[model samples]
Target: MSDATTSDPGTRARPVDVSERVALLDVLRGFALWGVFVSNSFAWFSGYVLLPRAQAQALSAPGLEAVVSGLYHFFVNQKFITLFSFLFGLGFSIQLARAEARKSSIVPLYSRRLGVLLAIGLVHLVAVWAGDILSTYAVLGFMLLLFRQRSDRTVLTWAGGLLVAVPLLAPFVQHYGPILLHGAQAAAQAAKASNEIDLRAKEQLLAGLSSDSFWTAQAANARFLTHMVPQSKRLLWMASILGRFLLGLLAGRYLLLQEVERRRSWHHRLLFWGLVLGVLGNGAGVVMQRLRLAGLVDPARDPWMLAMSAVMEVGFLGLAAAYVAAFALLFQRERWRRVMQVLAPVGRMALTNYLLQSVVSLCLYDGWGLGLIGKLPPSRCVALTLIIFALQVPFSHAWLSRFRFGPAEWLWRSLTYGRRQPMRLAPGDAPASMTG
Candidate 1:
């Protein structure tokens, strides 16, 4: 779909120069990871919804737990990853456009990139954590090719339709999901109670997580992944992901991010409408969940749960968009730009940092090291996440100061071309404004 195939298949794309980088993109990546990590801490490491509501609440201060639940469910969950997905699409668009502009073969290199991502994702799923999204992202990336040649208007129409439509339908999953999940949990509980396996095997394959050994962890991960990768959630999430991807693709194609100052009114409207929808939608969902938790309502019988959940889905997306708008608005100012620039290194090495988050979380919370697993409280999870990311900030700054690409990024680039990429900036090369 990209004219990346316009030139001879043997030809290579042009190399990236430091000055071509966009600090804004990097900062956004860094910012997104923080929220992404926070959202992930609970789900990836510990069960979120499956936990006893009382026990979950006990992890936080008596009253604070309610506030945390409201804030996280309404404001944080599912939002930042939406932003991350948008950014991934932006990267894909930029790569395709650059390859076409240079008249170089694109699909070979692009496919290679996706292949590496898939490989990493598999490793992440089996060996590290079964909650990996990289595999999904990489797999769906191939489908993006079908829409590559479409015009901006066509893309926007499809993107807008998806953004509005998919989320509204997510409620169907909630309606059926509980029934399906309850059945599975009942079966697992029954089996465990019957003691159908040896003690060691039982521990390894238990419903609760255990990562004490590589084989044990692998068994645990595989078991979890089976239940996690269901068709319903996968299909719906792909819809949401594609919607964001197409939106980012549209922006990247138009280079809208390059001239933020010129789009003041657009940014203002986005921030306003985005916040309005996001806050209201997610807020309503929070109220519903709260009522259900309070035993005042049967969530399934309440027809409003469907509508509320649907609104929350769209609202969360809006909140992510608002964040992007807020960042764009701030970037228009020199002073704020300077302060935010600190996140550039982290963003620039996003691949490395993301994997790093997974690795550390696995060690810290999984059975491999501390065996903390589901023991952490929600407030402690938030606190630990902050501490972990704060350390990564300075570490990223230090690593980028002496190298060009982050270690994993370098490896990915090298693997794409079947040769090692340059790892150090040239003498005259300086960090660029944007990384295209």
Candidate 2:
């Protein structure tokens, strides 16, 4: 996409117009949102992550449930979040291009946007869940501006480094950093002690989340967040997320979605490679995960754990890219386009739906709500996720029909622009469409 330059340099910064929206992006978001919910529900909301290895395994029945869990780990985990992070970066690119076109400064406007997102994320983290990604995105988003003016080769280089090289090196760092500092024996002892501490922490968190009082749960959530902040693992996660953002930014820079037809061959190649790499990477991951669960491989002690983790991480990106490519291809067909268009509204209102998923999931599983945490089977959690998303699709359509912006989106725009955005669509105005 050529830079958007304008004769008028004094034009005010504003949101992207409705007509300029990308329909495919929204559809992808909607699709990714469902996957996010599935992951959250199966792992976090169901309290599966908090369980000890033995207990978690006990919950997995030997036949259908085991198969479902294996399939999910192989294909679902990490893939959607990877896609979502890319979309974020892509959105940044879009904003940057718009700013260039208007001859307006992106810093002031973009910073304001990130600020609002950070505020929202903090609220979500403290008040709702510990898994909020918004604050992290906002923080790293500031760094993306540094790359805005960099050449495409430079951008791709940084992104590739973050995504591939970082993960490949992380395991060695995790294993060796402690030993180099404290010696092998001491490091092994420290690892054991750390494991104990982590177990106790999870137990405490489970207690809090399973408590009948809302304040108790909030306190537990806060404590968990506090514990997570200083950890090196969080840094790795942030790095991975930033890489996805850069990829998205790159996409936006080229107007990738807008030129899909012209780049059909490119997409096809991506689709093919994505499937091959995704399968190879995630297939290994599934085997490693199963071994870990069965107490056959310990990340702290095993020599092969490093390679396994790297494969999983790379596989995540591969699968996510494949999903995007496949979706793009299907969207080009008339019949598939009609079938998938229902997701567009949900995608447009992604922020609202994302937050809504947290609220609804908490209500269904947390102690203060149904108190079903740790009780639902993996299958049931998966089913509930589907049901929640099914409901969201129609809700998004109805809400969008009456309002121009989603509830959360309106708040974000209003806060960013320092004015209440127009919320109601004019009577004769066409509802939002992705025409870009």
> lDDT of each model, Cα atoms only?
0.72, 0.85
Q: What are the C-alpha RMSDs, in order, of all predicted structures?
A: 5.2, 2.5
Clash pairs, candidate 2, are 4-101, 5-101, 89-248, 89-249, 90-248
TM-score of 2: 0.96
Cα lDDT for residue 267, model 1?
A: 79
Candidate 2 residue lDDT tens string, 362-411: 89898999999998878888988999899999898888877877899989
Error of 1 at 211 (Å): 5.6
Q: Model 1 clash tally?
A: 8
- What digit string (tens of lDDT, one per residue) describes model 1 on residues 1-436? 0101122244556345455656678788889988998899855565443344566666654676556656788778989988998888887787777777766645777787788888877887777777688888888787777678888888888786676766565665555555477775674465465443334433444344554775666677687666557646577778878878888888788775656777778879989999998888787777777777678886445655665546777787789889998998998788998888888788887878888998888778756667766677676677788899999998887777678878878877677667887898767655432232
